[model samples]
Target: MRKLVIAISMLALAASAAFADPILDRQALMKERGKIVGGISKVVKDEEPFDAAAVLTQLQALQANAEKFDADALFPSGSDTGDTTAAPKIWEDMAGFKAVEDKYLADIKAATAAAPADVDTLKTQFGAIASNCGTCHQTYRVKKG
Candidate 1:
């Protein structure tokens, strides 16, 4: 029984070590951001009624997500390896990478202040932020299958 327990514990430790913590953390943050965007997207798509308050809440969450992201902490050296989709360009031009995130935060701030009262306004705000996301992904992400 003691030997079996030791073997199981060793397996658990190895399994946990298989994925680097930073990659996992960053991936989780991105996934949450996607969900927040999806919630707002439903309103933009007319799949859900335009509730300015609800949209504002989601926008706020997005703002928090942007605020919480620290590029250096999330993308440390050697984090580029493993199963990450982060482009090498991110490491090469960290300033540029940070600029991209800064632009995203600015868009969020602008959108929050505007506080869209209708679908059209929300669409415009969404477009600005979405465009920022697209730009970053294009320059800083690699599509790994």
Candidate 2:
């Protein structure tokens, strides 16, 4: 278990290394996070087979995704413009931004610690973490087109 977490951490860091441009890096991270959620959603929806290990890995990877943010670097000064959908409110209320982010990480950690081995339990835990995504997006993202 420790090895898996360490490996996921290394993969997360290595992936982040590709994004020298903070905007691009942040964007990529968001997409990766979404993809992680989507994979879990598939299992929840029965669109894919549920292996408990796979589900747990998904949650761990999500936690790693959350940890990748160096908020200030990801949302640096004057980054509220250009080819991005970050809401101005991020810069306007960064404390609130970080709080929401912290909440997200905490929820992911809680779900992971639960190590939900059954689909029903996974459903409950998954809902909590998934809701955080919707809540944050509403507050921090600008709808594009």
Q: Pick the candidate with the highest lDDT.
A: 1
Model 1: per-residue lDDT, tens digit, 1-145? 9999999999999987765488988999999999999999899999999998999999999999999899988999989998889999999999999999999999999999888899999999999999989999999999867
lDDT of 2 by residue, 1-145 (tens): 9999999999999877766577888999999999999999998898998899999999999999999977899999988888999999899899999988998899899989988888888888888887888887899899989
Q: What is the C-alpha RMSD of each candidate to the true structure, in Å?
A: 3.7, 9.4
Looking at model 1, which ten-residue stretch has the lowest summed lDDT?
16-25
How close to the true structure is residue 59 of candidate 1, measured as C-alpha lDDT? 94
Which sections of candidate 2 miss by over 4 Å? Answer: 1-18
Stretches of model 1 off by over 4 angstroms after superposition: 1-20
Candidate 2 TM-score to native? 0.84
Clashes of each: 0, 0
